[model samples]
Target: MVRVTGNEASMVLVMGVTGSGKSRFVNLLRGGSVEEGDGLMSVTQECQIVRVKIGSELAYVVDTPGFDDTTRSDADIFEEITTFLATQYASGLALKGITFLHRITDVRMQGSTLSTMTMFKELCGDHALKSVVLLTTFWDKLSDKSIGARRQQELRQEFWLDMTAKGSQVRRFDGSRDMAEALVMRLVDRPPVVLQIQRDIMQQGKRLEDTGVGRKIATRLDRSLEEKDKELEDLEKQISKASKRRSSRDLKQLEERLGRKLTERERIYASRQKLKASLGPEINAKVEKQQKSSPIMDKIQFFASILGMTVSVTTNIVLPLLGVAF
Candidate 1:
């Protein structure tokens, strides 16, 4: 419907592990109050766009749900983020850069963290690395500057070196508004390039399931299905044993958990199966229909034109009685 180009507001995507200070970082940038969560809870569960000023210009910063959110599955987060991004692109929102936050205090990169990063890479693709900012956050929590620096160096050498080698810039966030503003200012001037995912869907006419990310997610779903099947079998055996022992309380809890897991398993299978190998003419026709029906700018311009006519009417007729008060 909406043409996605560089004419709209500039958008910067902030993402990474949960509790890595992503919301706090965005709060400083936008100078707006976004809840900074505590403990194991992730603050941002949906992708939101906030407008922040960079000197004389205004830009948008997209605060995203964290990758390791305990409350949601990867599929849930992925679906939300993907839907938001696709909608934005469709509406002509031009993306400037993506800032990935990592906690400097974490001594080891946990598996969930790594899985999140892998998912991030798959979403962006190799070509989009040039627009990535590998930002290390929560630096103020570190007791020693050298420790942080050394850890940063180790990351460049061990994990992020490949990405940096490809054009991603690694920077340390001092958890200051100035630093956040500086990062936004630097990236907003760059030419907007369509992300690989955007290109795959829009230009190549590929469905979500055909992209590299869709394939990766499908693989995970398959493995998860296998695990769920095994768990289901084990739960059945346990339920049988509990039935013989007459433990009603334990049986009830186990049955409830079994029902939940079964529902989740079915959802995963359905999600995987619905992803088509390719987007055909039906999708194309729908897009075209949306484009025709959604003439938002034209409607606005019509109202604006009416306003212009009202001004003319005021000048010629109403002023005749007022007699040049100004």
Candidate 2:
């Protein structure tokens, strides 16, 4: 386990839906214990950062909370994740790459799983696809190897077609430490790219809700609220019928369900409010302050590094504009 004092280390974000083996994958790299969720309930409620020595480079592997969390709404998960990414980006910490894990044993991709993938794409944007790795795990658990192979092909042909076409790599994780290290080393060796969400927050000065992923989340929340309202309405009618029939047990169950749904609705409302809150202004302020204090060359280098442009391009194009001879 390699430890670093500063936060300037290259970062790799690991993400997927619940039960996708994200934490386990991180543990493999760190060679230490990271709390793994039991069955499908998400144990990683927040981002857990682990430091590892990938060859000569010290990298931070961030295990993020999975969507479909039992205790939190999807909106809550989204806000928590985006806030971390925005803060890191503003602080000049660019991700080396992103690894998205999926369970090969899953018979088919559920709606929530598909939504998570779509949200991830929106979060990373097209420019950052070259720095992403799509990983399918749980191959060791598959009794029949052909089943896993078929699912992998399906993902390649249908779900992952766009990402692969855009320069993302798709690889099967064999649940080995050697494989984990190899994957992470591949990422840390590449040039760091700024994710679209990061650019939206820091450069565009856009509110979280105005970001592409944020807007997608808002749409999902609105749809969830609508569905919850319909559920509550149906429950109300059922409760009324049960009460009229003097069925205490049925009425009690209906009332209980209604109460639970109402609580869930409130959580959704809270997430919506969190989404509307503006995080861009504060980050932009920090950026402004940093730019003011730094020298011209330093600023140029800083921007060039985070913007994912090559040093040669920055030297040739950007320096020329400032009347600086190379």
Candidate 3:
């Protein structure tokens, strides 16, 4: 039981879509099988924690369900994550880093992949992004080796530009335990940070629906419903056209599917409403304050550390070489 003893252990959240190698990544770190699945089915259902020792200190890794999950609703996934984070925060656990697993083989970032990244950033907020590591996986699966470098370069420029500019580190995971540990160890040694969602739901006593990320989640749900409505409308028009051709079987099946889809959407919306239940007024003054102040402080601190390292290198190596030459 690698319990956190007064913030000594760093808790890291493993995030990404299905088959992005999140469970495999953490399994390597903890030397345990976390039930990795295949072929469009989600393996991990909810958030599970595996604790391992990094050096002399214990650290914990949380494996979360991915986006586009076949079995679970988006609302369910979001709620599960929010509750787990809030529980950890209440237990005095502080997150030191978050690892976003992405497949190097994914040549393009659009659709669900892009939306997943957006939700992740919204969850982390700008303040906590400094501790994020966008760990790209499946390096060993590159069939054409030359293309891997090109794809990674594209990801850096096109996909990860803004987050990288905000102090997030990017690294390659080569399907090795040592590689995963090396990536995580760099973060576990750093100072702990409370994510914006954690701070809002814990310190300020706000509901999950009231937090900035929570509100973002709600907005996402709204957009999803709107999209689903459009999809249903299109299906209805198609069904109407198919009726003229006596394609009753397929049209009826499609209508049934749309009806079920609409019901699911309504269920998710109702779940949010039930959870909301007037959990007090939305008071996130502290979260707003941090958002305004953190970026400037973080940039200054980042540059200062770099300058210090450059000075150290000059004194330790460059100056000695110059002296010998003189």
Candidate 4:
């Protein structure tokens, strides 16, 4: 059991079933390169910690062996995760939250997946309430709009509803490069206990020396904090400007735009109804006529009719195929 001796940062354990892209998720979390070897085939046999420094906050992204491993008993896996958490806590590490990653491409949520999640909550006690985020991964695989929409709906209906019911934060995440950056930013802004731990580490380091290793570490941390603060200030300014713009906008213009859009929609719907009514009988008659004909004979006759029509039209013209083959 590895003990966290000092002010350990918050740990975000990235966990899910085998082939659910846990390692890839961890790589994304750490802003590291996700290589070809990083697949669903168990890249991590044990718990591995990747530390990231984001604006003076230390975000420890923990990657554990895939849950729902066929070789490992369910009880064994659950105990392992619990033991890892216990060790972290014992070592003075703050539990930030657990990102229960599920692949978007999963046809259905497995029973084992749900069981592990429940076990995690049970192990964490009340601390799990605020720290859990059911992070759905592999969103890139859901490129088809219709399929992606259905998958998202299923997740919301099946998993997110229950998670929210249990007072857990549930969010869908695309494990793409661009989305990874956004996720990191979000983690920094809403840091778990790990950020506090990082601050403690930096503070302690700063007190040691004015130059050398301590000074370099302190300077880097300070710079990160300053950058984060600046970003927050800019975001606040943008929000304020947006709010002011919204307030200044004319209500009458909005109302008029809404009315116009409604009127246009109504007109289009009415025209479509009218057209459908007019074409209904003709279309039905044609369909019935075709349906009454024998399938093979109909196609034969259809081609025959076209050939005959062409010949008759040509016969009436000059040269007329030498007056019907002389």
Best by lDDT: 2
Clashes of each: 1, 0, 0, 4
Output the worst ten-in-a-row residue range by lDDT, candidate 4: 310-319
Give the candidate order by descending TM-score: 1, 2, 3, 4
**Model 1 lDDT per residue over 29-54, tens place:** 65444667865488777776566656
Please tell me which model should have the higher lDDT, number 3 or number 4. 3
lDDT of each: 0.70, 0.77, 0.68, 0.48
Q: Which stretch of 10 consecutive residues in model 3 shows the poorest summed lDDT?
A: 310-319
For model 3, residues 50-164, the per-residue Cα lDDT tens digits are: 6666666566677889866778766578766776665555444557889998888887885888878887887887888889888888888888867888888788888888888
Could you list the CA RMSD of all candidates, in the order they appear? 11.0, 9.9, 12.1, 32.7
Model 2: residues >4 Å from true position, as ranges? 1-8, 227-261, 284-326
What TM-score fits each model? 0.79, 0.78, 0.72, 0.50
Error of 4 at 218 (Å): 49
lDDT per residue for candidate 4 within 1-326, as digits (tens), equals 22223333444667767777777766654444233234545555556666655444555566777555655433334334434443343234455566667777777767766655554444444434555566776767766757766876887777667656655665667555344434443443444443222221232222212313223333434555456555556555655665668853554454455465555445434322322122223323443454355233322123223223111110001111111110
**lDDT tens readout by residue for model 2, 1-326:** 11223334577899999999999998876554468865888898887667676555667678889877878877788777877787667656657899999999999989989988988999999999988888999999999999999999999999999999998888888887777777777787788899998888777877778988788888878889999999999999999999999999999999999999999999888888787867778655655655666533332244333333322110001111121111
